[model samples]
Target: MTSTDRPLQALLAAHPADLPVPAVREALLQCVQPLTEREQVPLAQALGRVLAEDVVSPVDVPPHDNAAMDGYAFAGASLRPGEALRLRVVPHTVLAGGPAAARLGAGECVRIMTGAVMPEGADTVVPHERVQIEGSTLHLPADTVAPGSHRRCRGEDLRAGHSALPTGLTIGPAALGLLASLGLDRVPVVRRMRVACLSTGNELLEPGAPARPGAIYDSNRHTLRALLTRLGAEVIDLGVVPDEPAAIEAAFRRAAREADAILTSGGVGAGDADHTRQLMQRLGQVAFCHLAMRPGRPFAAGVLPAGDTAAARAPTCLFGLPGNPVAAMVSFLMIVRPALQRLMGATPQVPLPVPAHCTAALKKRPGRTEYLRALVQRQADGRLTATPAEHQGSGVLRSMLEANALIVLAHDQGPVAAGDSVDVLLFDGLL
Candidate 1:
C-alpha cells in the first residue's frame, strides 16, 4: 500500500511524525481545529484582531462631487483660442464645506478653490494658475477645455454598501482608518482566544532567582507568552509547575477551567520523572504522541473536556511540549501557534520558508527532520549564507536567540556540504 493507505501505527513505527516537520504539520491540521467567534468590539480595540464578518460601508466617500483644483468654475464650451473672457467672479468665496448656491451662466465664471463644491451648471475648473483673478472679476484663458476637467466625482474612493473588508481579514491601521471614515465607532471582530501557559520541571527556576546546581532559569514562559501575545491571544500565565503528578494535574485542571487552550513545556519525554504525558492521559484524551522529529520528539497533544461540575463547563485544548528550551519553542511555533489561531477564528496558519545556502558542512541523522539554528547573513556577493550556530542541543536557548532562522533538514537527508541550498524557517517573517 502507498503511504496514504498505511495505518498510523505502522507509519509511526516506520517513519515518525517527530522526524518529519511536514508530517507533524499535516497531523495537527487533521485534528478538526476550529476558532471560536463572538461579539462586536470597539474599533479602537480592533487593531491586530481578525474580523468575524465582512464590513460594509453605509455611505459613499466624499458624499458629493467637488472641485479638484483652485480655479474658475465655468462652462468649457464658451472659450476660444487666444480669446480672453472677462467675467464677474461671485462675491461669495466657496471654501470647503461652505454653501454651494453659486451658479455660472453663459459667458460667466465663478472663482472656486480646491475641494470646493462644484457650482451648478459648471462642468470644468480651470486652475487658478491659468486664470487671472482681480477682486470680484475673473479672467479665463482663450483655450477651449475638456468638460469635467478637475472635477472630483462623489464616491470615487468607495460606493455606498460596498464591502470595505472581508471576513477573516486581520485589521491593520489602514483598515481602522477606513472604518472610521465610514463612521463606524465599533466593529465585529473574532473574540481573542484565551490561552494558559505553564512551564514544568523542578529543575526550572524563575528568572532572577538563585540558580541551584543542575537547574536553569525558565525562559520558555517568556518566549511562549511573547509568541501568544503576537498572535493576538489573551494569555494567562500559570507560572512554573513542578514535575510532580499532583502539581501537574492541578495546573491542567485549573487551565482547563479558565482558558480555551493550555500550553505547558517540559515533562512529555520518556524520562522517569516525565509526568506531563501521564497527566495528559489521566486528564483528557491523548490524541497523538511521539512525533518523529528531532529536538521535539516528546510532543503531546490532547483535548481536556469540561468537567461535569458547573465550574468546569468549558473544555480546553492542551499541548504538552518538550522540556528543552529550543525544542519547546520550536514545537510551540510549529504546532501550538497554528492551533491557537484556528481557535481565534483566523485562517489556517502557514510558515514561509526563505531559500539560503549553507556556509559549512551540516550533519543530520536519518529518519528525523532537524531544525538547526543558523545565523543568516548577506555576503558581499549578495547571497544569503546560513551559518550553523555553535551549540545545536535542544536545551540551548542561547543558540536560538543568537540565530535568526531554522535551517530545515529533511528526514533521511544525511550530510550537506557547503554552498548547498536549503529552506530556512524565519521566525519574524511568519507574521
Candidate 2:
C-alpha cells in the first residue's frame, strides 16, 4: 500500500527498525550519495566549511626549543645560596625567531627574553627581576632553578606528522587558528551545496504587497531560505508557483537540473489543489510521505534522476512540506535539515531534545505525536519551565514567532497535567 493508504503506526510497524528518529537518521546515512570534492580555499574563507581530509602538522608547532619566560639562562649547578654570580651579557642578543647565541658556562649567564631560544648548555632561567644588570654584566641571585625549568621544548603543542584536524570537522575560529599555527595558508574543504527554495499556493502573495481578498502573504519561503543559507547552502529563490501541476512540474524540472536539493513549502496534502505530490511522483521516486508527527504530518521526500547518461546518475533530493507556515518550518527543521546535511557529506545528524517541565496542562490526541509551541523560561529555582503559546493551531504563524521550543508530546500519550516533565526541541539559537 502507498504511504498515505496506511496509518502512521502501521507504516512504522512495517519497518520497525527504520521509523524511529535514530533509525531514520541511519537509513539516510546509508544512502550512497558522494560528498562534493574539496577545493583549496584561502585560510580566511574556510570558516564553516567541512574539512575534506585530515590535516597533519608539517613541522613542529613551536619549531624550536625556546624560553618560556624573560630571564637569565645559566647553569643551575653553579648557583649557591647567598652567593652572587656575574657574567657579560652576550651581544646581538637572541629574541623570538632569532638564532641561538653563545653557550653559557659555569658562573656565567645569558640575558634572555620570553620566547627566545635557549642557548646551548643553558638549562635554567632566572627571572629578570631576580637579577641586577650592571652595564653589560648580569648579576644572578644566589638561588637557581633545576634544569629545563623555563624552557619550552619543541613539539610541545604539536609534533610533526601529527593529525591536527580529522576529516569531517566543521572549520571554526579555533580550527583556523590551529591551521595558522601549522603554517598552512590554504585549506581543503568540501564545496558548498546549492539549494533551491519555492512556495506553492494560489492564495499566497509576497509580503508588503497589498493583500488581495482571501489571500495571505507568504512567509515560509523567506524563513526556509534564511535557514538554508545559514547552513552554508547556496540558496536560489524560485519565487512562488500557483496550485497548477504544469507550473509545479516545470519548477521541479528546473530545480532538478540546477540544484542539489529543492525545498518547496505547501501543496502536499489530500486536497485537489495540492499538486506538488503528484508532480514529485512523476519526476522522481518518492521515498516516503506523511510522518506520524503533528504540525508536520503532510511531508514528502524523493530523489529525481539527473538527465545525463554518461555521467554518474546523481539524484536531486526534494522535500515537500506542509502548507501551514508553522508546519512547513517544523518539518524542515526535523527532516529536511538532516537530509541536507547528509547530502553535504557531513557526519551523521542527531536531533537534540532537551527536557523541560510543562507549566500548564497539555491536551492532545493519543495516536499522533504533538509538538506544542512553547516559550521556555528559566525559573527562579534554576529549572526550565515551558509555557505553551496561546494559539496552538498549525496555521497560526504568529504563535511560532513567540515560541522558542517545541514541547514534544509523544505518541500514545494522553493529556498532560501541570508540572509534567516533557522533552522539548529547542529551535536554533533559542537555548
Candidate 3:
C-alpha cells in the first residue's frame, strides 16, 4: 500500500511508524548515517573499502612525451610520398624508460624504443620492419607512416593536478591499481562497519553437531555471515540464541555494546516463543512491520543504543528477518543488503532488473508482492524466458539452490500468463 493511504497515513501521524515494503526500505536506508571518521591504509588493504575523500594526482602519467613503439623517430615533413628516403641512424639507442639524449636534425633519424622520451624535433615514427637498416645508415619508405603516429603524449592517461578518484567509491582491484599508477603507497578510506549476526529459535542447532528428533541445523547464521563479509563488514557472529527473553536480551545487549549493526534471523513473529520484538521494545526502539510481500513479509529494523541514558554510545542498527530458510535469505537480500551498503559509507546502489518472458503459467495474487525462484534462460531468438520451479514454498531451500534468478511481482500484479514480460533479478555476477 502507498504511504499516503488513509489508515497508514493516520497511523504514521499518531504513533510509532509502521510502513509498507518500499516505505520501510526508505526508512532503513535513511538510518545509514554519514561517516566522518577516516583512516589511511596500505593499498593492499584498501580493497572493498570506501574512500573518505577525493584523491588528486600528484604528477602527470608519463611525465614527458615518449615514444609509443620501437622505431625511427623523425619529422614527417621530410618524407616524400611514394619514394624512399635515406637518413643516418644515431649510434646511441634510446631504450624504453630512459632519457632521450639525441636530437634529430634534417635528414637524420634516432633509433627509438617503446616508452622512451621523444627526441627533440621528431614528430613521427616508422616501424623498424618498414625500414631497411644498413651499417651506420637507414632507409625509410616515404609513405610508410603518418605524422604524430605512435607517440604517447605526457598526461594522456591522467592530467596533472586533476581528480584521480572521487570520494564514496568502493575500492576494488582496478581502483587500487590506478592509485599505484599515481605512486600512492596508501589511501584514505572510511573504517569498516562492525556487524553482529545471530540466529534465534529453540529448534535450531549449529552444524557439525548431532540434531535431535525435532531440532534442525541453523543455516541462517552461516548465510548472514557470508553475506556480511561480502558487504565488507567486520562480522561478530553471535551464533544461535534460544527462545527465552533473557537470552535474547543478553545477545542484543552484547551486540549493541560491540557492533555498529545487528542482524537476526527469525523470531519477529507475534508468537509466544518469539520474544525478539518484545525485548526490542524494552531495551531499544524498533519498528515491526508486516509488509505486503510474500515469503518475507515480516521485517523489523531500528536502533538500540548502548546504555539507558539518552546520550549513550552510537546506536546499533538491527535487522530482524523471518524464520523460514528461503524467506530469511530473500528478506536479507531485498532489505538488509542495501541498508548495510549505505551504513558502510557506500553510495546508494540499486539492483538492475532484466525483462524476461514467462514460459509457463503461474498463479499470483493481487494486493501482495511475490518473489518466485526461477531459472532465467535465453531463448534461441534472444528473448529471456523465466520458468518458475514446480514448488514455491517458503521453507524449501532446494528451490533457492536450483534457481539462478528471482521473478519480481509488484503488489498490484495479478496472475502471470505465458509470453508475459516480467522483471527478473539475477542472483549471480552482481555480488
Error of 1 at 256 (Å): 0.8
lDDT (CA) for every model shown? 0.77, 0.76, 0.81
Q: What is the Cα-based lDDT of residue 30 in candidate 2?
A: 47
Candidate 1: global Cα-lDDT? 0.77
Off by over 4 Å in 1: 1-19, 30-37, 66-153, 292-295, 310-314, 356-370, 374-390, 408-422, 429-431
**Runs with alpha carbons beyond 4 Å of true place in candidate 3:** 1-20, 76-91, 123-146, 308-312, 365-368, 378-384, 411-415
Clashing pairs in 1: 17-292, 18-291, 18-292, 18-293, 19-292, 19-293, 19-369, 35-342, 35-343, 266-323
lDDT of 2 by residue, 332-417 (tens): 77666776776776664545688899999877777667789998989999999999999988889898889988898876788998
Identify the leading candidate in terms of TM-score. Answer: 3
- Candidate 2: how many backbone clashes? 0
Models ranked on lDDT: 3, 1, 2
Models 1 onward score TM values of 0.78, 0.79, 0.86
Ranking 1 against 3 by TM-score, winner: 3
Candidate 2 deviant stretches above 4 angstroms: 1-19, 67-94, 106-114, 121-152, 308-313, 351-390, 399-401, 405-431
Quote model 2's TM-score.
Answer: 0.79
368: Cα error in model 2, Å:
5.5
